[model samples]
Target chain A: MKTTTVFTIGRQFGSGGRSVGRRLAEKLEIPFYDRELIALAAKESGLSETLFENADEKATSSLFYSMVMGTYPLGGGAIAGRSEMPLNDQLFLIQSKTIHALAEKGSCVIVGRCADYVLRDLPNVLNIFIHARMPERIKRAIENYGEDEKKAESVCIKKDKQRANFYNYYSDRKWDQSETYDLTLDSGVLGLEGSVDLIIAYDEMFRKTEGKKRMVST
Target chain B: MKTTTVFTIGRQFGSGGRSVGRRLAEKLEIPFYDRELIALAAKESGLSETLFENADEKATSSLFYSMVMGTYPLGGGAIAGRSEMPLNDQLFLIQSKTIHALAEKGSCVIVGRCADYVLRDLPNVLNIFIHARMPERIKRAIENYGEDEKKAESVCIKKDKQRANFYNYYSDRKWDQSETYDLTLDSGVLGLEGSVDLIIAYDEMFRKTEGKKRMVST
Candidate 1:
């Protein structure tokens, strides 16, 4: 094998990001995780699987808003118990741990759950963000989410906001910023297959370059 | 020569976007415009060059804020004359016209000034957004903008906000959003030369594909 390259994808809703990730993993013969990671986190955290799903890519935004407005009690200070801590935070920690564990296990593709931020310290990981122009996403939503155009766009926008908020809250870096990821591709232009091919090519080029660097150092 | 390819780049502040645009223009042997567009707009609008520079990528945000707050003089009605309209709107129109005129003239690279939004309707246009990670952008600011690290980050963030607001207010599409462009690359990942080369390759690929499409259609 050339190398075990890990990939983390951050993407806009309805952009066929998960589809591309799955296809890439298949083409690359690697494990793929999207909702599957949520399952693993649930298993790791010993929490109800439903809890993770409910909080998937979305924290308790209303609770946070109310707390900011001083309308909701925060239960306790910063030392709040695990049970007392916000559900979203608990979900994030378990998912973060699961992401690290997966990376340690082997090279694979992990989608969302802020895996880019969680595994950023690793040297072998490539973080990619996938998005399309709104019209394309709206078209994709019709196909993927089976929703009409207007509803799809609104849903897409809302989901992007929630995902951004989730990533921003948990990660030190802002979400979807160009620098946050190693590569940012508009799936709208390249299309899903092209995006997967680009990533694979990038991985090959990166590993070859790294191989040369290691040889020179040695 | 292959068909002319126009590129409009929308980028995050401190991402070395302008430099990349310049380098790409050189590599592609095409004309490049950044601040030059502002001068053209100033000429077109018969507005002071200083006004365009002052409002460059930042419409009179304070004026917009005041208008939003119902405090600014809105010139009596919605259909205000060019003389009574906000300085930002006049500048945008002139630049919009300039962008279209440039497209009609020949292929070129345009940076900022909402060029992507301005040229969105064109067939042979590639809208690329260049962004780097914050740490990388800070380093770039020191080298490119000659600012201290702390100030570089702050200025970068502030500039990004202003650019976003300027874009959001003027264009129907939102700024920095992935769907807003055809290609979004991380200059941090590919670096200047690599990014330019990538775009060239994409342009070639796009042209070949378009040739196939036109043949099939005919």
Candidate 2:
């Protein structure tokens, strides 16, 4: 607890990764960031919440591209060609900076936002990925997102693709790869509460060895 | 489990994945198969244990080439060009049959051997991939394998490559990709026991939901 620790969760769509991360943050008595990251980035960069929300977790979507390129507010004033930058890229930069700031403050669980890749250099950082079988994820999507079975299935694939593209675009490593993470668990099998318990118990080992530099990480 | 279930683990070298898998099998009161698989295949196929061991978990390596092929026992009879088959390929066929037989018998935990891909048709199977960061894996390699720091790191890479190549050559999917697995966990952060506990807890949920077939799986 003495050392600053950051838990970054990378997850599949409808996998309850965000919920489990929030529960883990609460159990650890640390701050949790999910959608609040968007708001923070919006505030920090003088960008509108709508822009952040539209660009949130989406990569190179035609809807966002057509509507957000030059139509959205560019804040109070901007340098030339600022509008030329892709909306997703701009939003991602702001959120990445916000994630770094939040990580520096103290211990926290930051969900999505490519937080794992952003903070990969830190020894105190633990990157966890939560995923589940297709059927389980579809069930969660139906229960939580109020989508019907067919819609849930399609939406799940689309959303995960967006997240993968978004993460892959910004990070050096491939998104959702097990090697890129410290721990990967199936939320479908463990459920949200069960996942929280596993993370807490696992993080204890990390807490004990946090400050000790095991070896030079390349 | 009310109905039979098989837990298949795919792991990186020196990641404690094999140890954790053995512990999980013990905790679940199920059979554990690792090197024992090679022994079983040798017995079932009338091949020498040494032949199986030499070809065990190994990919197409020229270093192991010329030494195993056609030199080992081809059993009591010859099936014409049977000796022409690479020793690793022969071992793999026997091991694959052994894995299928083990899964059919009852619940068990089978490590490596591409059991995940081999049993893809089974609804009662769970495929898990275990990996850890390079530094943690390197430290484990040094402590467990008695290799120096540099040797440990290099050995880690080589072993993982062999495992990956073996899995990829035998299985339909890539070895360690997250999508190929039902779950992936880091034993480095969780330690062997912690990893076992997590698997057990996660499998408990699976036990409850399994055998019921939430939907008709084709």
Candidate 1 ranges with C-alpha deviation above 4 Å: A42-51, A60-88, A147-154, A177-179, A208-218, B40-51, B61-81, B148-150, B208-218
What residue runs in model 2 are displaced by over 4 Å at the alpha carbon?
A: A1-5, A22-31, A59-88, A104-107, A121-124, A142-154, A208-216, B1-7, B22-32, B58-90, B101-109, B119-126, B139-155, B193-218
* Interface RMSD, Å, model 2: 3.9
Write candidate 2's Cα lDDT for A17-98 as tens digits.
9899988988889999999999988888776888789778876777667766657556533425557776777778778889
The clash number for model 1 is 4
| Fnat for every candidate | 0.28, 0.32
Native-to-model Cα distance after best TM-score fit, residue B58 in candidate 1, in Å: 3.3
Chain B, candidate 2: TM?
Answer: 0.86
lDDT of every model, 2 decimals? 0.74, 0.78
Instruction: Summarize candidate 1's per-residue lDDT along B91-129 as a digit string, tens digits.
Output: 678778988999778889999888877776666777888
TM-score of chain B of each: 0.85, 0.86
